[model samples]
Target: MKLRTLLAVFGVALALTGFTLVAAPGLASTITLDEAVLVFVGLLGVLQGVRVAIARSRTAYEQVETPDPEASQDLPTPGDEFDEMLATAGADRREREMRESVRNRLERAAVATIVRTEGCTEAEAKRRLESGEWTDDPYARAFFTGSVEGASLFDRIDLRRDNQSRYHRWAVHAASEITRRSEGFDA
Candidate 1:
């Protein structure tokens, strides 16, 4: 059996034994034998359930980092001006594309959230989302909290690698960028 299963079984067994001992001492209690057994089983189920829940709650997820395609490859020697220029342009294009993709993802999510939660028009929602004061709206606040938590950088990389979804990958990057910009603006 898996370690979690084994541990849960052991915990339930212990609870059952302990409760049985306390409830039916020398068979002289007011409670009948059947009632004692029922109580013991109930305690066992609860103990097992608690152990399983705790085990599941403790599980954590992590993202695996993939090397950037541009950065991973060796650059041209310093003397090769044309090669270097091309490389720089390519890197810049990649960076811009990444930024644009992330921005689009964030905008869509933020605007949708604002529109849905605030009963606002798309234009107003888009404006509010771009303004960066998302916490003013109750729905926006909860949405941001959930998005940031779910799209955490560390977890999203692996999620991307595992082909979880395009939106998820972009959401993680966008959330981080938005958070960074907001921090600077606040300061």
Candidate 2:
């Protein structure tokens, strides 16, 4: 309660009272002086509330953002990082080892998911993949069992045209199928 703030508030209330009296001389005839003072006090309270709100909003905007280490712990998803690995693996011969690693990782994840959902042993889950009974997707079945020979003669030739592209497409489809199956879905 600084003297300056008190005086400013009092001055504002008084000016509002005078303005009300001058602007509506007809109302002044109906409303008593005590009621006029009460109205001025209420107006002052509303003005004070609005002033506080504006000051708070300005201060909130001016505050600097502080980083939290825990909040910054977001990591790239396994699928996203896998996509990057596949891109790098396809672009260069040196990433052949990474490509194989990625393939193994994808297969392992699928096998694990199948085992978890189907209540089967790992070997049985892999057997399902070998028989193409795990999923109805031809590319996924081919990719898992490493058999690209079952398509039509022309289709097989087309699939063999670019091994990298074919493998990438199979990998993406297989990943999606695995994700769908893991979520108790069949698509």
Candidate 3:
């Protein structure tokens, strides 16, 4: 125990002596003590300046921006209005004005599609849509001709508001039918 304690004390003393020799001013290195002090003080001053700048920037950001409320907001796309109505139709479950808007848009879309694909007049397209001759899907035909008022009870029973309404389903079916007809005509 005594020998170990002595060795530890000797090691510490030797380390301190070496440190003193190396840390002494006017040493073997080319950089003098004055130049090292100036460099350290300069680094500290730069760090302090950076801290002050960051603090000032934080306060500057805390102030209110310009008076224009919409300056930071994104602009709506061209089709956003119609898309919002469609989304409302999908979420609300019960059909209302939004559903009507969706139906109206889809009806127009169906007529336009008929006009384009069948190369018929607008009046003939409307007649086709009204007579339920545009597509073979029964639900889609009912959607335009008002043959069926609402879907089955199961289609309207979305209590969680997660699933789309029956009207949305009919819309999707109608759109797919239109797309299919358009593709077939093109082919």
Give per-residue lDDT, candidate 3, residue 85.
Answer: 79
TM-score for each of the candidates = 0.26, 0.50, 0.45
lDDT of 3 at 7: 56
Residue-wise C-alpha lDDT for candidate 2, range 1-187, written one tens digit per residue: 4447767978986788679979998977999879867877887787777777766777745568888666567787856878888888667867779879878988898889889888899999988877888887777787778765346777666766775776677777788898888898442
* Model 1 agreement with the true structure over 31-76: per-residue lDDT tens digits: 6889978976887687667777877788896789997676566887
RMSD (CA, Å), each prediction: 25.2, 10.0, 16.0
lDDT of 3 by residue, 1-187 (tens): 2445545755786577458658884453667679867865776566566666766777744566777565576889875786677778878867487788888788788888899998999999999998888877766777777665445656445422546665666666676787678777862
Superposed Cα deviation of residue 150, candidate 1 (Å)? 23
Candidate no. 2 TM-score: 0.50
| Candidate 1: pairs in clash | none
Model 3 bad stretches (over 4 Å): 1-84, 93-95, 148-163
Who wins the lDDT comparison? 2
| Error at 94, model 1, angstroms | 4.5
